[model samples]
Target: MKMKVESVNLTDPSLLLRPEPVYDGKPVSAFRNFDDDENDPMKARVRKTYYDMHTNMSVDFVKAKMAKWLKFNHFKATMKEALIKLNDLVDESDPDIDLPNIVHAFQTAERIRDEHPDEDWFQLIGLIHDVGKVMAFYGEPQWCVVGDTFALGCKWGPSIVYGDDSFRDNPDTHNPKYNTKYGMYEPNCGLENLLMSWGHDEYLYRVLVHNKAKFPKKALHMIRYHSFYPWHAGGDYQHLLKEGDEEIKQAVLEFNKYDLYTKSAGIPDVEALWPYYESLIEKYIPGVLEW
Candidate 1:
């Protein structure tokens, strides 16, 4: 059956009496911690996926990926239609919740909306944050499309999750050009010049820019680096920051709260929330867009 998108009325008195969405007060560490051996086999799957991502996502790999994906010829899709495609993506690299990816999208967006009600574009950014994972449905491996992203051309910092041992076998680890502290990039060159590990975050960021979506640069940063746990979460890669990197870093940090801490087993009424998001998508990214 086709998924139903229901419109909800927020001003209804009876609905107001219902409890707001529960947040459970979980710390970010409790969210994506994949080291728990006692956890389900899914954790093992997540571990292996990150291993592959860390090993193969070198600078050249990123450049090749950008060349292939940035062409924007994959397909044309409306924003909502592209987002709905995430229903089929179960990220093997995330140790967090295992529900349909779209549910996580709605959950993240709703949490942002709860606090920043007036920032509709920010809320819309939250909703479609992972929409580029649609590449998974198009036959890309989960390793390339999901998982935490990191700077590819530069040194893989020790702060990267599993960075110490996981990337040892990667060819770039020993390459003279790519193994240094500042591989292939200048000091304080800014993040825009860096080639990040190829993933949904970079893909979606490029998509928004390519389609000329009217989101703020801050929202674009949130989309681009939401998975760069090393920089935003682990405090690595500071040597490469340019003049205003601090402000963009702060924006990513703020968005991270809603993205990570708000994940819950509970699902959102996607249908009830669709109308509001549909309006936002129309305002920012209307009609079919190049992928």
Candidate 2:
């Protein structure tokens, strides 16, 4: 189901989902390789839109949104329990493989760790890469947890698994001003100038940043771009990029090759790696992550 039409239909209204582009056009079942589907062609013309950096938001307004969400009881569970629960999301949207969510995340992270054994921080990134999926276990819909990252800029990626096109059925896409190619931004702005949909990549990145952790810039790039398949892999939207963004794009593409093409069932046991990581965390994070 990696075909464009199918990938374009990830959030079928019939399934209560909207159209999005979270794949190379593959489908998943109890048994199927998530990787290659012989006939799927994901390399068509580029899709419009990308994540934005600056929001049209004011400090108080941003604070108000955070305050509203902060009022909710997001979670109250141990990391292990949360990890177990996180797998329950079982992305019906992701068709390539049927591995449980944690298993899928482990597959991505573990491969990253094995090939670059010297990069311990990437090992942690591999292990906890999808920690944002915690939101799935916390009662957010798949649309909320697993979509594209974007800024306050207009017309973000529609292929994000957890979001629906109905999200685009609003005035934003049609409004004459926001409908322009750049929306709320000037041309060639860097990602640092954008704001994305609130999700796990940023969540984990914030944890590392605020605590002054030692995650590599590459690891940080992983957190940010694992979901940004279009620009990195598809070569879309380069017209809006700045001078050096291409180099950043190249590095992200190098990292993405590892992320997409590598997966194995023969890796070392994740359970075996946990004890060492637990110590690493004790030294790195606050008492524990919130959810």
Candidate 3:
């Protein structure tokens, strides 16, 4: 919640447990590989999800979604209630972890807790990072509610899952105002100035701020840009980034390891873990939130 800020010891040995991380037998580099393979059903499903997202997620579409969902009028539920809804969701965009999204949630949270036991806010951030996917239950498609996000108005980044071929059907690709290198933005505009495609990252970030959640600024940045792989993970958008944005990128990268690699980790006892996490939720984001 609103705890006093303490300097984190980045060199803590627990954080280095996985120097070359491997999950369930697959190496870390093997994860997030969006290669198209018709013979592999999981690969096909992942491909189709990104294709649908890149095809339909235009500047207008993102704006319309913001106008529709940002009102926080779709429904109201407590943080625990909202997270429980994820029990029924399976992200089609994910190449790993076919289990219910709730399993991944617990896995991420437990992993964060194990490594950063002192940082309750960081652990809570892991628990609820993907809770915005609850938008799926409220009539949004997985393409709009899940998956990696990119800047909507500029030229698509080279590192986005399927690259240019996937966005061929998107109308924004043909518009001069939105297809240029710096489309609708100035140089060194910084990550905050860019309009990202609609997804759970931005949605949940807004929800936390709108509801007055007291997590530190770094926690909010972790939630907001964790899905922005192209910029943080792929080295794109350097021209648009202002000075000090490197800290944001590093924060997202720090959070990303637990989010991405923990999908294949063993599932935690959600029932047993709830008492601890619920306390943190109560401290930070208690009560029914407008969604």
Candidate 4:
């Protein structure tokens, strides 16, 4: 049977009530924390979804997984077309960051270049890292892509995207293996041994991996596991990693600074910056990129 996805408002109780962010190991709703000056008060009135971090994701783990499947460039269409499609991607639950979709994608990529002018490849990664997020805009649901990426073996962690209260309605949670922590998986299986949620993060990575030489081993690693905050930040999946996963973990940790810290603040003109990015595409990815 095809997987059944429930159409939910972006503000569905599940998303609003999530324990942490779906991609980074942080809060899903900064509702209460917004007023507190202690946790990043530089900006005012942060959108609640901005707090939606990936408690399950880590920058390092994302790097390792993305290196396995990296993309070379942004959407094949012109930036104008890409922006139209991105704008259509409104989250019913995540009403806070209501900017256009391309804006979000651009902010992430542009932030990288601003901080690390020396790392051209990483800047490239920022451009398209979340492009696959458009799948939801195309018709898929949040459950299919935006959530804690877990193994489908025997036991699943209790803190999945929805957690206990939210997953009460999910059929997958009932399956014996799906409910267990290591469901259908053995110890130290490593993320390579798993399949993640089908989203733009994975899709974009696959595109780059096939394109060849889009990003270095380290940057690719950041692309894949940057959303996997659970492993690196919480060390939840340490049980699934092997001895070989150590070094890459360290590299991903460093990359996280840029991904989260680099906001859409004080940036140059995106339209003007395209020429530089376009040149980088010619140098690294092909002039013709796969959608």
Give lDDT tens digits, candidate 1, residues 78-184: 99999988887788887777888899999989988999999999899889998989998777889999988888766786667665578888889889898888898
- The TM-score measured for candidate 1 stands at 0.90
TM-score of 3: 0.92
Give per-model CA RMSD. 9.3, 9.1, 7.9, 10.3
TM-score of each: 0.90, 0.66, 0.92, 0.66
Location of the lowest summed lDDT over 10 successive residues in candidate 1: 1-10
Better of 2 and 3 by TM-score: 3
List where candidate 1 sits over 4 angstroms from the true fold.
1-29, 36-39
Alpha-carbon deviation at 269 in model 2, angstroms: 3.1
Candidate 2, residue 262: the lDDT equals 37
Assess candidate 4 and give its lDDT. Answer: 0.51
Q: Clashes in each model (backbone N, CA, C under 3 Å)?
A: 1, 26, 0, 48
Candidate 3 lDDT over 1-291, as tens digits, reads 112111111122213444566566777656666656667898878777888999999999999999998899999999999999999999999987798898999899888999999999999999999999999998988999999899989898877777787889999999999999999999998889999999999999999999999999999999999988777766789989999999987788788878887878577889999999999999999999998
Between the candidate structures 2 and 3, which one is better when assessed by lDDT?
A: 3
Q: In model 4, where do residues sit more than 4 Å from their true spots?
A: 1-96, 264-268
